[model samples]
Target chain A: MHNFEFVKPGTVADAVAALKGDEAQALGGGQTLLPTMKQRLAAPETLVALSGVDEMKGICKDDEGRLCIGGGTTHAAVAADGSYPALSAMASHIGDPAVRNRGTIGGSLANNDPAACYPSAVLASGATVTTNTREIAADDYFQGMFSTALEEGEIITEVKFPIPEKANYQKFVQPASRFALVGVFVAKFADGVRVAITGASEEGVFRWTEAEEALSANFSPAALDSLSVSGEGMISDLHGTGAYRAHLIKVMTGRAVSAAA
Target chain B: MELSDSRTIDAPREMVWQALLDKDVLKNAVPGCQEMSGSPEEGFEAVVVQKVGPVKATFKGAVTLEDMNEPESLTISGSGKGGAAGFAKGGAKVRLEDDNGQTVLHYDVEAKVGGKLAQLGSRIIDGFAKKMADQFFTNFQEALEGPAEQEPDAEVADGAETGEKKKGWFRRMVSS
Candidate 1:
């Protein structure tokens, strides 16, 4: 809540330069950072706003045929984009209308909340996180709960997702917050199948390899019947027990696969 | 809310007990601890800042160790006020056991939050508390294992590394 400088950079280069200050932080939609500042939990001396950067705010298919979403692109834009039906549907449901309109995909992925929806899609879709400095594969990008492989002062420029043969995201939302209490994202490709679960693990979003293997062989909800998710690393809280989340993981995954199939 | 966890440190029980009493180690081990004062016998006072999602608050609190089990067990209870954000009161029963040459530490913690934080939902609060406990144990374990093992070359660059890891957990708990 203390006084701080705010700079809206016109380009990614300027934005990165503005973030070079001692306590400077990147500002996306202010959906997350603003509230934290108001509570006085985070007192950055300067905020380098990325919203004004033109190069970081669009969605398009790259020359390589991968779907590329600029980091500064809002959830609302992603929701409206018809090229990827599953991703658009998932984006439309993120945190009601206000959050969708204000929160940016870059902010969501950079923050990497365990219950956040973006990580599931990014991980399952086998995306690449393009930063100001380098490109990080999704597998290496997400380290753990709210953690990523991004170095200090690194800015995410874009996220590239390879369009899958079939993909779907199913989120079992917690009524109060609307966050995925347990969400599953299933993506099928010519090479194989990938399944990622969010809002369940203590460590954060992770691939359900066993379910992926089963579904790879038989791309149907019934294929998940014999596979069981263990509660070993699942989170337990007032909302649900670890066992319940483990059960929901299977249920959600099954639903996602069924929808995708 | 109540939480129970156990961790084994690669050191003797006596060494672990001494490390727990060391103010410097405790300050570093505690997540977001800005300042700390006092002693194990008379009690300790500290200022800690915690952020879950968009909610952040600085808490000033006091803790006292009760029961006289030497290096075996003790109970720590404390309370802190974070202005409009809320207040939290909690206590933990800690036990240390000898596992061959190493020491096993077990803690049973019970805590309650009132005000804006309580309204945020127990699930988020539980997640934050769990992460804090985990971070503390990790730091404590690292301290007990000695600083000699830390990479000398990267020590200068460790400030950002430590802050990022700590921030990651906080952001994770709240972003959900």
Candidate 2:
């Protein structure tokens, strides 16, 4: 909206350098940031584009048996990749082709919109978020809604997810925006199960620890028969009430667990 | 919507009430207040800059103290316009109770927004309002507990200026 300098850096180092400038913000896929700018909600002096940084744009596996995805990788790319089936499936359902094509995992995580898809996957998988400087666990990285442990000018270079034996994500689609009105990602590992939820909290993406505990004990939908999600601290808007989201969390988690199991 | 919270400050209830009348205390307690000046009775002119996620706005408005019941309870209300961004108005009812040497401060806040901001999701608006209200009260509590500010002799000054016109909330700035 306002006249601003745009720098498309070729590498993460260069992008980091570019962001060190006064009032400069990193540009990911421009899915969230661009619209925010157009809305005049945000006006950064400069935007350091990460799209040109080829170093941060792919998916692969490390020797640790972890699925490592470049933060700059587009949702479309993640959807296309089959290395992590649950993540891929989750990515495929994000918005339409236009958004998936342009939205980056780094942008989504960094923005940490409460309704975003990627957070649930990363959190559920117990993924490691690697920035230019250091690696942070997903639990520590996501502080709250639209908040993160990211420092100013910090660049997320890679995300390492320990591939689960079986996993699935179930999201109740908010028809208008296609964002998860309430989404649950259920991942079952050798040790236990992790259930992370998005689009349902006032506090942003959070793991359902009670459900995690129950589901871990018995990897079945019936294991959750006695448990119910509390409506407290849930996101209540025109799209859905907190009570509605609380109910959907149970339903979605059940669906994910059934599918994953 | 509505939000309520309470905090206990080491300051006396009377001192806490006097601090409420201080624009300096208010400016510091407000999350992003850049400027705050003027009398509580006539209202204070304030400029506050806030950033919620990606949205940033500079809001300029007036804060008024209404329905004051001495050192017991009072309402602080403010409305701000942020150009094309929109406008936000909110009020908080603060009640102070004496607890030996300390004071327990309880506040209930309500907020409303319009224009471009109202279009933003209610979840965000509600969350931000809660955070702001919490921050304001927490800041006030901490400030009250911290090193003391000078005792405001505003009442004597008010009596000097008001003469015999009125004895209530009509506080006139006196040239000491």
TM-score of chain B of each: 0.80, 0.81
Candidate 2, residues B1-176: lDDT per residue as tens digits?
79887888876787788878888778867778888989998899999887777778889999999999999999999999987689999999999999997888888999998888898656688877887787677556645554225432221223453244232221221111
* Highest DockQ model number: 2
Q: Provide per-model DockQ scores.
A: 0.26, 0.46
Model 1 misplaced stretches (Cα beyond 4 Å): A1-3, A35-43, A231-239, B53-55, B147-176
Reproduced native contacts, each prediction: 0.29, 0.54
| Chain B TM-score (model 2 vs. true structure) | 0.81
User: What is the per-residue lDDT of model 1 for residues A94-208, given as tens digits with 9 covering 90 to 100?
Assistant: 9989988989999999888889999999999999999999999999888667767876689999999998999999999977778999989999999899999999987788999
> Model 2 misses residue A26 by how many Å?
1.1
Q: Per-residue lDDT tens digits of candidate 1, residues B11-106?
A: 788777776776766776777777789998888898977755445578999877788588999887777898867898787788999999899999
Candidate 2, position A121, lDDT: 96
lDDT of 2 at A240: 83
How much lDDT does each candidate structure score?
0.82, 0.86
Per-candidate iRMSD: 3.4, 1.3
